[model samples]
Target: MSSLPITREQILRVAELSRIALTEEEIEQYARELTHFVDMLSVLDTIDKDGVPPTVTLTFDPIAQRDDKLEPSLPRDEALAMGPVTSDGGFAVPKILGGEG
Candidate 1:
């Protein structure tokens, strides 16, 4: 797949979606940067990878299992005492986007 060329409108839309208000100069600079990045990615997309298998590591026998050891955790009451607001043995945080309280 080919990378797309970014436009000013797209940048504005992205800024709106991200809830960031960008100045005119910043918008222009970001649009140019994004366009250049897409162009570079287009060049990368032309490389051949037909026979290559995707793997996280290049070395053989890279996987190893470690010995598991039991570790003592803080007492339940002590842990709960550190929380700002906890209930039912769990930390309770405020709603992230103001929906569920």
Candidate 2:
């Protein structure tokens, strides 16, 4: 439509913001497509949806949650023994960065 409002400059600005390089033809295509999409969305806004309820989820099943219960875990020494290096009752991994913190 002639009234559909996306300019070449606006399209270029959007492409710059998105870090994309669009050719002249692609830019024209996107400008037309985006304008059409926005027009469609505006048309949708005119529809009456007061009777419709907002949906959180469409699924019938309730979300399952695991029961929290205290259980015996592996002993500190036994767990630490599996590690390549154990210092001060903990696992020691190789230093990743040059810093002593």
Candidate 3:
């Protein structure tokens, strides 16, 4: 069993560091939930996996990848014609990163 225990003070400290405002009820609830999570991890620590190979994925089959091939693309004018909005022979999209649209 793990000697370290999750406490309400720890939860409150974490909440404060994360700039999250929690009610007294919420603080108590999170303290219990976090403690349970740590207890579950302690249970995993009791399991013997010394000889087990670390698994990156559940499947044993080899991954299949499609062969990369050079393909002809549509002409610039034809491709631009398909766009909902086009400017200067290219598709024009709304600016998303706090820049001029």
Candidate 4:
């Protein structure tokens, strides 16, 4: 509640920094909405929770996870066969860092 109200200039500046184009009406709308949101959050400051414990999660059960296992891979020759170019038993690609393709 002690925080200063949001301003149109602040909204416009934020939109400019984000590279967003906003109309005059849109800027006013966002300024009002952001001010309302902050006011609502400020209400939390008045709550009394002296004996309450912070909640981490709703459930304590261990999460089920699939076991990691190695599987057979495709043969190199067969894999290279699908490529447009092949060289030395592997797929051939153009050199990116520079020299020769």
Q: TM-scores for all candidates?
A: 0.48, 0.44, 0.44, 0.44
In model 2, what is the error at residue 65, expressed in angstroms?
5.6
- What's the distance in Å from true for residue 47, model 3? 2.2
Give residue 10's error in model 3 in angstroms: 5.5
User: Which candidate's TM-score is highest?
Assistant: 1
Q: Which stretches of candidate 4 lie over 4 Å from their true place?
A: 1-3, 12-20, 49-60, 70-101
Model 3, 1-101: lDDT tens digits are 65466788999899989989999999999988888788777877888989999887777788877679887889899888879999988889999779988
Give one digit per residue, the lDDT tens place, for model 1 in 13-91. 9999999999999999999899888877787668898998887677687578766977887999998998989988899
Tens-digit lDDT track of model 4 for 62-94 = 777767888778988888888998889988888
- Candidate 1: worst-modelled 10 consecutive residues by lDDT: 1-10
Name the TM-score of candidate 4: 0.44
**Cα lDDT listed for each candidate:** 0.85, 0.86, 0.85, 0.86
Clashing pairs in 2: none
Q: Give the deviation of candidate 4 from the true structure as CA RMSD.
A: 9.7
Highest-lDDT candidate: 4
Q: Which ranges in model 2 have alpha carbons more than 4 Å from their true place?
A: 1-3, 50-57, 64-101
lDDT of 2 by residue, 1-101 (tens): 23458999999999999989999999999999989888777866777998899898787889776789888999999888889987999887777679663
